[model samples]
Target: SLKIVFNFQAGFGILANMFLLVFYTFIILCYRPKPTDMISCQLTFIHIVLLLTGGNIWLWDIFGSLNIENDFNCKATFYISRVMRSLSICLTCLLSVFQAVTISPSSSFLAKFKYKLKKYMISVFLFIWSFNVSFTSHRIIYSGIFTNVSETKQMKVTKSCSLLSMNYIIRALILTVIISRDVFLVGLMLATSAYMVIILFRHQRQHKHLHNLSHLRASPEKRATQTILLLVVSFVVMYWVNIIISSTAVLLRMYDPVILSVQKFVMNVYPTITPLVQISSDNRITNMLKHIQSLCHHIFKKR
Candidate 1:
């Protein structure tokens, strides 16, 4: 039952992210893409790949036929997934910071920094990719299948590749690195999101007498900022929930299948919802979708 639930969730997540990937790619190709759009496109593309890879692993685990049991395949999937997850958080932070900087008052320090950073956006993206890849290299080295012996004198092979460290000191160091990286990224995302929210609030307050309107309806920048904030909040919530569940499982040394399924479901939630939020908030995508629907309707009417 848990396996069925996981497969269902993974299938839905893959389809959603695949549509997002294609939509963003269309935007990049047909529309004048902003820096934010480019970032979103890259993020969506990564999500699609991650979802496909993750879904395959889950399906394989259920069917028990696909031969992904080798060390190389395990390391590749584990490493790529870890790197992509970290990259997703970093890209989200970049998106929030970019939106915040774009919406900052012209005379503010952020405005100045934004001006300086605009010319080197590609370089910044490259740095993020390199840094995350280098940082997560340890996963490739530490992840492999291991055998465990139960008290009943029965030996079982672990189904999935996981981090294996016999040395306590080495394990501690790895754990420290992983935890610190996650904390730093999550902190950065929260701070940037908070700053953007404050800026939006002040702007709205200053114009309160003009008209009462939601921040999302105020301006394009505000709408984009609000959308990014929503994305960040959802990502952080799901990310931390998965983290907490996994950490608890690790600490208790208990591998409850239901708990693991719940963790994966939580982790997939953000990817599933991100595209929906993006399309709903952006008038261009919504307009494009509507146009497509109308065209199909008209063609059917002619038939």
Candidate 2:
């Protein structure tokens, strides 16, 4: 069933996000992340909550065997799931923008506060949560379960819940704001990344005479930066693909269950791929794994 597929994807996404959240939290606890790293940590945790909540709704739908046509819980479940999801998207975009700002050049305005307000990171996260909470409360208030016509009467036999037209308009407005934020941050990220690349290229050339073969290649920061850039690119690509698919479905006034199932699957990739990106590029993670392997070998030898 379509519900099963959606549940599967949502479960996968939640599990992946949980892994990423734990990994990052370990990093943060073991060694305090740079102020910028805190943003990523927070974002990952937020995503875990989003995916878990969304997964619960789909799982409930798959198992409840309740008619959406007459079910209040069905409507509330979807409303909450979507609100959490949209909030996650918005928060991730904010994280990306924060990182881009942190890495910007000294001459840039964002750079002015980089070292000055490092203590405000917690407050910043609180603000992000507050924003999302206030923005989506109306979903809890205005949304409700509705009965659809039977298959012979008009639409399909399967029951489903949806927002009313007025609520949908509100959702569109909120989504537009989130989309605008994503676009602006994405543009800034691209510009900042390009600038860093150009600077690194020039530096690599300048240092060619002073360093040996390996040293002449990419610096650690350059490699790490590139990895983070790739992470951003992956997030952006996945987001836009989902947006495109969603937009098409909305415009055609055709909510195909198949496409929704596919969308859920696509959503899982971002969190799963994100951890691998960090692990592959981070010397700390590599060293941690190596340390664990050595410990295992030592214990085995003693046995």
Highest lDDT scorer: 1
- For residues 62-89, what per-residue lDDT tens digits would candidate 2 score against the true structure? 5466543344564456556666565555
Q: Roughly what TM-score does model 2 have, to 2 decimal places?
A: 0.78
TM-score of each: 0.88, 0.78
Off by over 4 Å in 2: 1-16, 55-58, 61-76, 101-110, 149-159, 167-176, 212-220
Pairs that collide in candidate 2 are none
Write model 1 residue lDDT over 183-254, tens digit each, in one string: 887898899899998998898888888776653355788889999999999989988788888777677554
lDDT, model 1, position 67: 60
